[model samples]
Target: MSGHSHWANIQHKKGAADNKRGKVFSKLARYIMIAAKNGGGDPAMNLPLRYAIEKARSVSMPKDNIERAVKKGCGENGGVTFDEIAYEGFGPGGSAIFVDILTDNRSRTNGEVRKIFEKGGGNMGGPGCTAHMFDRKGLLQVPALAVDEDALMELALEAGADDVERLGDLFEIRCDPTAFQAVRDALAKANLSTTMAEMTRLPKDPMDVDAEMGRKIIRLLEALDDHDDVQSVYTNAKVTEEMMGS
Candidate 1:
């Protein structure tokens, strides 16, 4: 969870800057649209949509934008139909990479992804090539000062969490996706604040890379994330503070 927390902190900082530039709005919209399409427009009845909207809000995506995306998915504005796809691959230093994409044009997305991988010194692998090394889990980050570790552990476990780990100044709680809301609710009831909560792919094992390789992998991930069609990019690369600072 140390590695997970480090990456989460980095992402939180990066996301703040990206939101100011509206760079993350597009991705948030796509996620909202897809969630609505899959689970209907009612967030109350759709947990996934609820989660998507929360994520969008976390990035400061405007309320108007969120509503519009929901409407688009509900066919109110005749939005383009998007298909969700996951691309798996190996990046520099044999890092396992997983890319989530939303697009109406499969051929275009494939070509663009391929080119980015090539340029980043990586190669796209067949579906399931890298996905097998990961598991879908609900992750929650709680600030260290918010609660005592022992008490937090008891609460999380009683609420059906799988594990809890201390990461620097945060508590990382892992739970089954189905139990995410329950655990979140329990924490909230206890007046605990969460820095972030989401159902994300967790790597079974991480690959450590030298500073140079770490930079290359991060660049590759950033480039993939920058693509309009890419929703999110997950990797098993263990990036150190020294590597990130460098």
Candidate 2:
């Protein structure tokens, strides 16, 4: 139902500018380990672990690496603990930004994140600042060329999805977080493949920006995402490749 597509940001993130594959893998492993530790390694019984594993596989994380992380988290190896934190802020164009973080030392990570925000022309805010601008939901992105629209709509809706609509070249299936598994399972069973699937936050009001503002917002978001402790970055701004000026 939304006109703004997150596909542009998704495309930007696929760039290898400064994101080394090893560092990306390490971050995903942390996610997997924490999920497996909190809940058992069984993805069926553990929704968080299922999401973590799905993210890992999306990045092509090795099977051996994923199994090792699960074992490590299950206490087969020494247990390491991490704290989950959410950082909120406003970008150059007043776009709301939300960052997910996983860190062992909150103080250090906080300082680092704040510095990144500042250097990128933004300021990190206290709790509940930017969070109110977004809604947590399940987003499954399927390429338009992949499946028939009516079929996807029927299958997704029957599986408890809230809505299904074409966003640019992709069909986005939206659902409540609780229904994500059911919807995902339904798609899997029907052999309908997705380009991307995840539990994510969608902006309540999509931010519109000029080319200059779009460049600044995208830079700030990319900087936040590249941090070692940062897990994910979400923004309300709709930035296209053309807006990322040099």
Candidate 3:
């Protein structure tokens, strides 16, 4: 598994996702509101809002909460304004790291994020430094037992997927961001169920690190992920299975 994917599976195994379900919902709500606010309240006319709504629905976020967020974004309930921001930095082993944030207070968020990087033995960099090292892609993970590899590969490729890779007990479907919805819809039409689906940044060249450095990087990633204002964190550090075990 890729480092980020492994870490996500670890979090799921640790029950962190379930434990922090409320926080997850809140983050999803913020994403929906921002999308709606930027592109208008109509999901049909708003790509970002549609993606946000689908992500929320996949996680079983309450319908009422989703609707409320859309309304708030449309200025129906005097919603709080938020700004989307990105932070770049280097973690252990000089591995590049990128963070996506949504916050009402830029200064406060900047201070807090900077402290996190400093505390994690990292230094912040100017914008675009690390962003250039990654590409945004639509990723879907389906359990191996749920679909035949040959069938899925053929189906996904025909449905506009870039590749279907077998990673341990899961099959990862990757595609361009523009084809994300279409690929997903195609899989659904074929009655394939995915365990995880989302559009995320993938490192173009993952940098390998020693176990010690890997641990340090994981610490920094986790710390950043725990912050309420942080929506996502991407890193070029690759963690081996042995390092993960250690």
Candidate 4:
């Protein structure tokens, strides 16, 4: 697996822990609200909202909570409006970092994120500094046991996917941003369930970090992820199983 995929798998495992604490629900709701606000309340007409709803359902978020978030975004109920923001920076061992945020107060969110970076041995960089090193793409992961590799590859290629990679027990599918939903629908039609499907920033060149630096980078990432305004954190830092277990 690539460093990015490895870290993603680790986060997928940690998602269970986050759900137990109810943090995952909060984050998922925020995403749903934002998606609804941007693309309207109907999931059928709004691809992003449909994606957010699927993610929330996978985490077992209550239907009522999801409905409330969508209503709030549609202004059926008074709720704080969120603004999307992205922050780029460098972390321990010169690892490239990208943070996606949704917040009502940019000033406060910016200060808090900057403080987290400094406290965790990283320094925030100007916009586009680290972002230029990455490309945004639709990523989908299907369990290897779900279907035969050859069959899956043919299906994905026919669905307009760019590349498909075998990673241990999973197959990672990459696709153009505009074709993400179509590709996902095609996979579903093939009877293959996805483990994860999301738009993400993939780094062109990953930075390797020793165990010590890896641990520090993970800590920084966890802190950022825990913030209510922060949606996702992307980094190029590589971690070994030993480092993650530590």
Candidate 5:
């Protein structure tokens, strides 16, 4: 765990993601709506809806809120339509930043994101700028002490994971995006708990940066993530726990 793994763990410990629960719920609702509208309101028939519902439920989102979003998506309740967009850019030390966005107002979000990048010591780029540098995959985070490494690896690999990596006190399980749910179900059957699980873009090349530059890169990531429309942000800047003051 160097860039994303380290940063995610640190953020989890800091309660950074949970601190903005209201914003999280709203973003998740948008995710559900889009998934439902694209496919159908039934999770059994819609894979994306199932994933979205699971994520919302993971965060303890109210059942009524989820139902209403489903209704809105199915045209029972009027609501704003959102577009899925990806923003690619460069942060301090030439580190790559990839942002996943869901928004009803593209023009407004575009302007705000550009300013965020500039203010955080970075610059926004056109499509395929930094996006080509990453591969979309499923990543699962687990504490080292939670399970035996060899046993966990065997189970994950048997269930379709590409590999299991041991990084300090953390374990990262990487798998093909399509196999994510299978691997997750396998772990659950074995009574294992994961701290974080998501399909994300992983950097092809991790960039080494000094502490000062790393700090700048993280600030840019934080700012982008704080935005209402930004759902997720990925980076390639390599920094240590001590350097990030984790």
Candidate 6:
């Protein structure tokens, strides 16, 4: 979690910017559709759908769009069926990269993803190449202004959270995947709101790189993220603001 929270914060700011371009809604729709496809249309009985809907609402995704996505997933409204894939790769300075994709056409998405990797000083690898370097966990990011640190820590701990730490202006609470919903429910009952909440892969160890190498990795990452088929991009690159600036 050393470098993850910082990167999550960066992504949060970047997502706000991306939202204006409608990219955020597209991504949210994909999440909702996939969640629905996997776990039925009712969010109440589907934790993934519940979380996906919550995230979509956080970004102000249209109610109609959400309903359409759910209908599409449930096959009530005809739409292209999406398949999820995780691609592994390496970026500058041996940084491990993981890409989560939801696509109707795997061949096209794979080709495009491979091309981006090649052009960005990286190369796609066989599945599980970099996946082994990460751990899947529940991450909840709460704003610093939302609650007292000591009190939040106690709440989270009592709720079965794995750990709670401050990441810049936010407090990041980590919990096991099994306890994610419970922890979230506890927070909600306490009237604590989260800035971001998701189940994500956390790198075991972040790779530190020089400014030039970090910049190259960042460019590769952003390029991968901009692809329409790409849902989420994770990397072990530990790049600082100064490194990004320089």
lDDT on C-alpha atoms for all candidate structures: 0.86, 0.82, 0.84, 0.86, 0.82, 0.86
lDDT of 3 at 16: 34
Model 1: how far residue 101 lies from native, Å? 0.4
Clashing pairs in 4: none
The residue-level lDDT of candidate 3 at 224 comes to 90
Q: Could you list the CA RMSD of all candidates, in the order they appear?
A: 1.5, 2.1, 2.3, 1.5, 2.3, 1.5
Global Cα lDDT for candidate 1:
0.86
Question: Per-residue CA lDDT of candidate 1, range 61-104, in tens?
Answer: 88999999999988889964999999999889888899989998
Task: List, residue by residue over 1-246, the lDDT tens digit for candidate 3.
Answer: 355455444433332364345877788889999998999999999989998998888777889999999998888899759999999999887989999999999999999999999999998999999999988988888889988999999989988998898889899888999889888998899888887778788888878787899888888887898788988888878754455544
Whichever of 3 and 5 has more TM-score, that candidate is 3
Q: Estimate, for each residue in 1-246, the C-alpha lDDT of model 4 and write its tens digit.
A: 366556666666677679999998988888999999998999999989998999899888999999999998888789648999999898888889999999989999999999999998998999898998877888899999989999988999988998899988899998889889888999988888988888887777777877888998898888888898888888877765567655
Candidate 1: stretches off by over 4 Å: 4-9
**lDDT tens digits, residues 26-123, model 5?**
87888899899999899999988998898788777899999999988887778548899999899887888899999999999999999999998899
Error (Å) of candidate 3 at residue 147 is 1.7
Q: Write the per-residue lDDT of candidate 2 for residues 1-246, one digit (tens) a residue.
A: 474456334642553333355777888789998898899888889989989998778767789999999888787878758778899988786788899898999999999999998998889999999999888888887889888999999999999999999977889888999999899999899887877787788888887788888888878887888888988888888777776645
The global Cα lDDT (0 to 1) of model 3 is: 0.84
How much is 5 displaced in model 5, in angstroms? 2.7
lDDT of 4: 0.86
Of the two candidates 5 and 6, the one with more favorable TM-score, higher being better, is 6
Sorted on TM-score, best first, the list reads 6, 1, 4, 2, 3, 5
Candidate 5 clashes between residue pairs 3 or more apart in a chain or in different chains: none
| Residue pairs with backbone overlap in model 6 | none
Candidate no. 4 TM-score? 0.95
